[model samples]
Target: MSSAPSIPSAPSTHPAPPAGWQATFSEAVRLQSENRWEQALTLLLPLAEQMPHEASVQNLTAVLLAQHGRLAEAVVLWQRLLAADPGNVALVANLGRACWMLERKQQALEYFSLAVQLQPQDPLALLNMGAIHQGEGRFEEALAWYERVFAVDPHHVQALFNSAQLHADAGRFTRAHELYRRVLAIDSKHVIAQAQLIFTQHYLEHPSPAQLSALARRLGAQCAAQSPVFSNWLVSFEPERPLRIGLLSADLHDHPVGYFIEGLLAHSAGKEVTWIAYANNEKRTALTERIAPAFSAWNEVFRWSDDQLAARIRSDRIDILLDLSGMGSGHRLGVLARRPAPVQVNWLGYFGTTGLPGVQAVIADPRCVPEPEEHWFSERVWRLPSTRYCFTPPKNAPEVAELPALRQGALTFGCFQTLAKINPRVIAAWARIAQRAPQARWRIRCGVKSSEEDRRSLAQRLVQAGIAADRFKVEAPLERQRYLASYGEIDVALDTFPYPGGTTSAEALWMGVPTLTLSTPGMLGRQGEQIMGAAGMAENWICFDEDAYVDRAVALAQRSAWLALAEQRRAMREQVAGSALFDNARFSRDWHELVRNIWRDACEQVISRSSQGISGPKP
Candidate 1:
């Protein structure tokens, strides 16, 4: 009877449905579906208040908030919704994504793990976990997660592509190539996969001109058919306006890229170019501050959203956007894709193609991207006259005055590249060299901060090769200046195989330390050979099989006179200084010419469009 006591008759008008709440929510969902995140957020807030307990609505509201970048608020809402429906895999995944957007790595990992546990076959959760691991530099762990994603869903193109990148990073080019091929097989129009496959093929010393040409054709066809709108927004032409050249880099402080750019900055005094530095990497030091004054504006873009940073660049009307991070750590290729400036160029960072359609050109030397190899790149190759890349030694780098004398009793060999560069083959070769020169001590300087595990692993490798523990020395990471100074303690720097040192090799030469490198066919692997060739030490540039590389290293270590020649050491340093390696003026001139050419090409397109009364599609 009480139940039958008339469930109060539903209100006739329902109070006119609270002023556009449904309409607003529908509009919000429409905006969200269109990926117009900010507009969705603007409508979502009041709609969320009106439907607080609607699980789907709440979940979507949180996601919308996160998309608008209100991460903390989004997290709170997600937590509230998860509390009610704790087993909701989608909600958990969305929360995890928001956590990642906020850089709450551990929280993100936990939520994503929970989502995966709840739905073992969820590729999104697994993929997100892989991304988190990749961001943290745990590429192998990332690869495992990506493999799991692939196992659950073979059509997971992102997982396949990411696995390829992880394999490439680990120097497992064969596996990477297979993964890239899988991606291409799935979607022939997949530009990234196509570009990466071409790059990996070239990297593994398997150049395919046909593949490169096909890739170019695909890109050109897409550009033509879609009529992609390249931004024409120009920085005001101040004829006398000091060209505001913005250099965006994650390694602006004391990284190798920083070291190379320092020399250029040192030589840029009184130039018309006003440098704008965007330091995106951590570890700001006194050296970074010292370099800051050389720039007209120095910003830390990590604090800004992609749009905010893009807007800042547009507002500043940067004449040239020089990206020093080419698909490396903390690279801002996404921002570059927005076409932040009239001219964008990749220089001194990534050696290969960026595969970004927006990049106008890649700065390189004729030695690297020779005319015959022009088809290999998505962007035009701008060849520097002498060397596309240059090395700038620290101003206060100590002269190796008498340090060679200390090596009379024992020859110390050094390699300062990362442990990641020390592939199993590289270690094996080093072990062979160590065995040949019993009196020589092998010193490996890993660029990463020292860890007990790193030391133990390295020691195990050396011991496995039948070398005594006492024969090997592992030095901790050093400040840029201290690292340069540490080179003084070594007789010769042994370059790694299949992926040789770039900055480290140049640094060694600049510090009066000779580097002997074995040239590999891959462009990245032969960087040391190129640097040494430019430094006028091609005699020291050893191109041999693995066995011969070891033999050369041992021979160089055993010859005491060769190691102790003060005159020769001084001459090598002088040659490095005078050679194309340190000539900033020549680099600047080359850069200017390339920019002019790009401008001319762009201007011609604009002229053609104007004459035809044709406006290209918006990007």
Candidate 2:
């Protein structure tokens, strides 16, 4: 979304217009001030044509046109106005914004550059420039622009939020958390910041599950207050009719969530279910093409408003709606909050509870959400027969290579998790293991190649943890194929605690490399433990504490232990390949049964309530 502010409406700032036209222009401006934009536009259009050379009339008309989504027309009008007064910063900024809305990136940047030169203190111009740089993956450049914005206005919420997001993305969660806190202090109801704060808590020191749940619940309640829940769905409770299951998510492409759901979508359901996909993003990948056919119907709901999407689901008579995105990226929790379907379940995309009252349950296996930890979630813990996750390996993945330890003369321990999860404690544990097993090599994928600052910071932290600086190296992130193939270079993959590697751990196992996991409290922590159990790896590889984790990792890197792991890693991959993790047919049966039974159980409850003259409560 374009962040450019509208042209300021200060009449005194402009030159006096011709005598007879003053009242008419004043009336138009008055209408705009009164929020009657349509009336304002109507009054300005004829005046704009009659007084073709009038800067005030033309600029006003262009602003109106831009507000009405006529970006091309607005751009032309602004261009003409700029030719008349080339140094007008407002005109320059407005033109830049119109070009941006039209997706003319280069033109927008040029005009924005002039706007900044004309008025270096303009907040809107700086913000837009930051957004463009951030979009292009120039993180440092984007941060520089945001820093300029902060210098001008420390309370600038957008700049603060954007910078926080970049920090979070680069795995500097502590800094991200600081910025998010500042934004919330300025504006308590900032939705994105609230969600981001919830997401960031885990990456820091151990965050209590209850505290996170409470925060998520607040967000859920906030969304629920937007629109009233609907409860008048009239449908036949037939046990045999095909259940209409609607899936809402933005990650329908080749992402971590996409990989997790691939097998479930591919599993044939025959007539037992009708799958409808609500892809919340426009950019689709080859993985998108692969999953499209599996759905009975597909709708690109990216442009759909919450009410519009909820109405569509209600109109479609969807029996069950699964929220795949939860509070993660591209989540439309508002639609779910409106209770668009009879039953709503939180699924694979997010590991934790959604904390949404609209969502009835969270899909998990017994191992993922063990009986004792069931209270951690706001939603009911609906346990699957085995593992809740099923995998579909990437088509481009190479065959598992022989373990590098045999030929490389020493074992190498690696962790390719996102920088955000490698907290201070994780760094300390890894340092301990590195120090104990001095002959073993360490490669920690901190983030992108440009994340030099983060790598340097991590390196400093490792040294602080008592490990020799020369014994370890912080590596740059790898491309997908290379990242997967690079796994064979290591004897063992070390999982990060609290927010352990989910997709990374799975991929390492697929590449015939085993991961040693340490259990921690929250939902995200359980993923590593669960994935290891699902893959039928050695249970001894999972440690209960940091001390155990360090001990187990060092023990695995010993000469004899490393020698034996060459064959164990290959066998581990075979185990994962043969396990329920990739069994699409078995996963399909279990998933469908779960969905079917959940709806049937819901329908029966509604019927029983109706018979007893009691009202069924909204989820």
RMSD of each: 7.8, 5.9
Worst 10-residue lDDT window, candidate 2: 4-13
Model 2 lDDT per residue over 446-483, tens place: 54534777778778888888878777778887777787
lDDT of 2 at 389: 83
Candidate 1, 1-619: lDDT as tens digits: 0110111122233222356566777787898776566677777777777666766667778877665557788788878777767778887887777777677777778888887777888898899889888877777678899989989998899999898887776556788889888998898766566656655554443344445456544654453344333365655433344577889999877677877777677667666677888777646866687778888888877645555677678788687788987646677655776777767788887766565677777777756566766666677787766676777666788876544635467677888976656767777777787777887787788866434456567678778877788988876788767877888778778887666788888878888887888876434655777787777777745665777788777777665556344566767677778888877666556666565565556556556666788874112
Model 1 vs. true fold: TM: 0.72
Off by over 4 Å in 2: 1-108, 448-450, 615-619
Which residue pairs collide in model 2, if any? 171-420
Cα lDDT, all candidates = 0.71, 0.80
How far out, in Å, is residue 409 in model 1? 2.7
**Position 460, candidate 2: lDDT:** 86
